[model samples]
Target: MGLLLSSCVPTSGGLPPFVNPPASTPYGGEYANEILKLPVYPRSRTLDKREFGNGNSRVRFRVEGVNVRMIYNFFTDQIEDAGWGRNRLESEGQNRTWQGVYQRGIRLVRIRVQQEGNSDVYVLEVTFLQ
Candidate 1:
């Protein structure tokens, strides 16, 4: 009877696993004076947007139905096309995270993205010189 009851119970792993940082991760607050025309994926949603000191800005959003590599490529290419040079790119495969930066002269932009383990959502945080 005990063995049967144990087997009947559902396991947490079978359900949706919550990532450490919640799904709606924001780099800045809800509103900003300046709007950063960031490259958003097709199914991306802006969770939060805000501006910081000296015209700097940041945005946090989530992209759905896309792989980590695809998201990384799209954002990096978009940055380069916008005249920002690729400065650094670091990948932590074990942690399922990637950090990249772009620069053109004194203007700089940075992007940090992490894939929710075993999930279809990708959390992205972008900071740009305004």
Candidate 2:
């Protein structure tokens, strides 16, 4: 009878796995105050409409770390794309580092995940640079 009950119980592995920091993964310290504050989730991400290009009010996602990257589409100037950035597993400690002067226009920034591990999601507001 005990064996029957054990088999009937569901396992935790079948459910959504929770993330464990440090050992399993390490999210670098937050930088770029503007991008650090954006609304993001496990499967979906978002941003306010007045943070990026101008202070006139517009939705723009703010993000950081070594997991995702926002690519800019030179043509349409809209972030209709999102995916991974760069891999930190092989580049020692510089895989997720990105540096550049973002263009002054409406460009589609796509978020891309580079590493193979748990994803960290959070929500924040877009504060324009005044």
Best by lDDT: 1
How well is each residue in 15-103 modelled by candidate 2, as lDDT tens digits?
32453333532443454554567544343433322233343223344333223334333343333233322212122342322222222
Best by TM-score, which number? 1
Off by over 4 Å in 1: 1-94, 104-106
Give TM-scores for every candidate, taking all chains together and pairing residue i with residue i.
0.31, 0.20
lDDT of 1 by residue, 1-130 (tens): 9998887665575643343434653645543312233333543232221221133332323223111122223323221112224433444553455456565345455555555443434455655543
How many clashes show up per model?
Answer: 0, 19
lDDT of 2 at 39: 44
State the C-alpha lDDT per candidate.
0.39, 0.33
* Model 1 TM-score (2 dp): 0.31
Off by over 4 Å in 2: 1-30, 44-67, 76-130
